[model samples]
Target: MEQSSKKSALSEKDGVNQPQSLSNSSVEVIKQMRRKQPSAQELIDGILAKDKVALSRAITLVESTNPEHLEKANTIIQACLPHANKSIRIGITGVPGVGKSTFIEAFGKHITSLGRKVAVLAVDPSSTISHGSILGDKTRMEELVKDENAFIRPSASGETLGGVARKTRETIILCEACGFDTIIIETVGVGQSETAVHSMVDFFLLLKISGAGDELQGIKRGIMEMADAIVINKADGDNIAKAKLAKTEFNRALHLFPAKQSGWIPTAATCSSYTKEGIDTVWKTISDYFELVKTNHYFEEKRQNQNQFWMMETINEQLKSNFYNHPEIIKLLEENKKAVQNDEISPFAAAINLLGKYFKS
Candidate 1:
């Protein structure tokens, strides 16, 4: 009877030990298994949790064309929608050697000093001949980029026109969603065809050098007329007089142009990026412009329109990509190119035929 009682006790111990072993094994299995992908809410929570690393990764996903990440990116963007629209979007552009980067660093430093966050995006146009971009602008923005409150992203324009990457507009949305509060987009100083940036940004700032007479001569009227504010850079020491003269000329030139969509008049001022002088004046003008537009109730309306514009642009980009990727369309384009080379069809006719064939159901 004692032996039977001892056996019963052993059985009871085994029963409890078996369950404990299984429980430990189950946990080990769970730990070895791949973690389930995070939901959009989870992603946003991670971002709001002040996870800078997560924010950086999320922005990368949004900028990516990876098929696997696109859905996740879209979801994250949706979650971030409500928390967005709290930032000021500024577009800065100038010809080469106009101290664009210097001014930006100075300007960015000034903004962040007020305890606001600034995100600067450099748009480097892709070189047609080499299929590469010389992304040197960010290197010049050393001081601002080092600031804890500043984030800098340099994007390759790739075959996109307008001196900006096609994804730049989308990137702006993501940045604003991240609580940046101030977003600055710097475009490759393409003399003209940069109005695309103007449409997307609240303030369009044009930077000019003091002695760019020949360079400015080549600039088209449309870009000049599109500017909300013109900044004559390099206004230090010997060039101060020339900078002052350029400012006067620009001010006079601006008067001849019509008002912007915001109905705000563009102002021209001189500044020395090297010395950081006149930087405050530039910011003050921007502040004044914001006050004027906000008071007129044009600020909100302008932002709404910009959002709609970007939506249409995004759709068009997707459709274009799809149309080009279709197998039959690709073959048709190749055949059309051969026909054009053989003089069997006119260039215009081939284009029409290819487009019609692709679109025909």
Candidate 2:
């Protein structure tokens, strides 16, 4: 480098040029990585070829809130439609304290051991204040997370199940197209999350632990009716006897619920994620359900109905998003909310006022 020592303050000679921080080729590569999103056809082809990286990227696009990503994600879903619906979608839900992650890992590893590819879509609850989620399913399921035959994706349970469930449903399609034969959706088990998951899955499993006195007392009637199998998890050590008792109680409670349209009688089973005991029984139970449903043709019928439900849900989600995002409505919503909270206006009136302006504008 050369410098001008004898130069006027305002007329200093230009210093010799320094090398670029990055090469032109390196810059081009970085730009391509940042700016070039894979085409829908390219993502579809990659998914069909069972590429995990492509599957993850495609799922990310589906979950993205960006308008452009939404368009591409829809296109990719349409393309993968032909290959989807071939896998059994199972919904597993339990209360917050239940060992859902551990049970899922054990169950998933067992499924993969049987030479089947498994994909887990675990939904973590988001905090109301911060809207941030723990997203720790991958961390919790270390062994299953590392398995070559297993794929785990953790998604945040947003304000509602509408958008997140839709994304999860689409992710299922992508995973199926990528050759995953079994898809498991693990819900955060809050509010209506289980119901949303139940609508999409073929077999619904309600996981439980032996505690809190009567097991039947803790279960919701709707969940019991929806559940194809109620499996009591953590049936290891001193919990074995309690688990068996819970299983018996659950079986009796299951008998009280009316017969299902699928003509399948839900049963209560026990499984130990620690000892791997009765894990196979859970699979056998799931297999038995699929066999019966397929034989009775309820499997295809349910899929058709689920597709219709998905359409309605998508409509609801889009309308909700549009209403909340309206500039005119956005200005008035907080005013109405504060008015309602202060008893200046009834919630119904506030809602009507907001809805009226939203629709009018």
Candidate 3:
């Protein structure tokens, strides 16, 4: 009888462990379901409802290189097109270590406080060897991450130039569709990245710092010309005097440039992100810019041009892909490359030969 009782107790202990195993299995099943690819309608509905999970999935789908995902991503974008173009798109660029992330955190929190939904599409540098992103933006913008009205996405990993991701333009449309009143795209801050950002945004903000010496520490002159507003960040404590001087210098520099097409002068402001000082002045500058451009009809015209530019860019990208991805062209390229390298053929001849093979294939 004692042996039987002991056996029964052991059985009960095993039963208790079974529930724990079952619980883990159930959790995993739920995770698998979430990981399962969602349908186009499901993604679109979730995005329209401002579901963060769905919005993130949709962005991943758009960034995917898989053919099936690409098709679905296109469908989702097409469905959301009508709901887009309602938000103001702003592009922020600056050299690295200029406190871009800190300034954005302060600025984003301020924007969200005004009851506006803000989305930050921050682009981070990718490793050339691994082809992966550093993904440090999310960690940097702690305050904005906690804000209910703000959404911050780290840079996607893939081919990029001038620090702007290839699919950023499409991502902007998705953000706008998600009912975000303000969309901010933060570029990788390299000089070339500014041009790409400028083409997509209503307002291009060039973030600068004080005491950077005469050449502005390698910032391209062309980038300065593209700015709609120049903001000097980190203007607290000992930096305040230098910031004011920098602001004055920038204001004088703007006067030397020809007037903008919108007939609005690019303005300069100084701000301290840590203390939240002068943040409002930056917002006011952006607001005043929108009013001026809208009044003169430049806003609509610029968007129209941007659309046309993207259309051509898409075509160019597709043509290049088609040619390079062709099987015969791939084989011919290898042969022609070796021939040119060995002095067996001229570079031009090799290129023409490859083109002929590509067209025939």
Candidate 4:
């Protein structure tokens, strides 16, 4: 009887443990079901409805390099193109330690308060050694991050010369499609990125600060010429006078540059992100510039030119990728590199040999 009782207790314990194991497995199955991918149409519908989750997912799809994801991303972009071009795209750039995040938070909040949906595509610097990104923009712009009407995405620069992600233009399209009235593309602020940002944006705003050397030294002369407006940030407390002086200097220097194609002169403004002063003036400046450009039809013309530029850029990128990725080229590249270093072969001859092998293969 004692033996039978012990056997019954063991069986009951096994039966109890079986359901617990099954329960744990059932929870995992539920999680997998929750993570199942959404279809393209669903993503489109959700994005059009201004669903932030869907918008983020759509941007991720656009950023993906996977072949299948790229195809789907292209389809999504094609579907969304008709709905885009409604937003005013702005590019904001400045050197490090110029308070770009604080200014953006203030600027973004001010815009959102006026019933405008804002989207920030902040490009973060990727480490050259690890190729990984800090992606800390969201943390820096806490107010904007918490705002219901704002969408902020931080992308790795991936060592692109322009300090922008390769997919920034596509990301802009997706953001516009999601009904954001204001789309801000924040570059990594390494100075070379201004031209790339200017090419895509309707207006380029250069954020500067007083006491940062000559205002021109803070930004390259080429970048200054490209700015639609120069905003001197941190213009509060004792720095107000210095900010005004910087603004004066910037204005005088801008007068020396040739006129813009839009025929509207670039202006300067002073703003204190801490005090939230001059933020509205900055917005008004952008609005007035857009109004003037739209009246002259330059806005449309610029976007058309951007499209052509992107097409050419894509073609060039593809050709380079194909050339460098060829198996024959890869096999010869290392050997030729060593030969060149040792003076066994001229660099020109090595190049020709590689090209010959590539073409034959």
Q: lDDT of each structure?
A: 0.81, 0.89, 0.88, 0.90
Compute the lDDT of residue 171 as modeled in candidate 1.
Answer: 69
Worst 10 residues of 2 by lDDT: 157-166
* lDDT score, candidate 2: 0.89
Give the TM-score ranking, best first: 3, 4, 2, 1
Runs with alpha carbons beyond 4 Å of true place in candidate 3: 1-23, 214-220
lDDT of 1: 0.81
Candidate 2 lDDT over residue span 1-361, tens digit each: 8896876878867799999987999988999997987888988999999999899999999989999999999999999989988899999988777889999999999999999999999988888899898899999999999999999999987777532445888898899999999999998876478778888899999888897554955465887888999999888899999999999988888888889999999999999999999999999999999999999999999999999998998899899999999999889988888898899999998898889888888
**What's model 3's lDDT at 158?**
63
10 residues in a row with least lDDT, candidate 1: 12-21
- For residues 176-216, what per-residue lDDT tens digits would candidate 1 score against the true structure? 76668899989888764377788789988988886757335
Q: After superposition, how far is residue 39 of candidate 2 from its true place, in Å?
A: 2.2
lDDT of 4 at 39: 86
Cα error of candidate 2 at position 286, Å: 0.8
| Tens-digit lDDT track of model 4 for 1-361 | 3555445543544243333435887898999977998888998998889888998998888888787998889888889899999999999999888999999999999999999999999999999899898899999999899999999999999858867898899888888889898999998898788888888999999899998685759445678888889999999999999999999988888888889999999988899999999999999999999999999999999999999999998898777879988887888899999999999999999999988888887
Clashes of each: 0, 0, 1, 0
TM-score of 4: 0.89
Which one wins by lDDT: 2 or 3? 2
TM-score of 1: 0.84
Give the TM-score of each candidate.
0.84, 0.86, 0.91, 0.89
**Lowest lDDT 10-mer window, candidate 3?**
12-21
RMSD of each: 12.3, 7.4, 4.8, 5.8
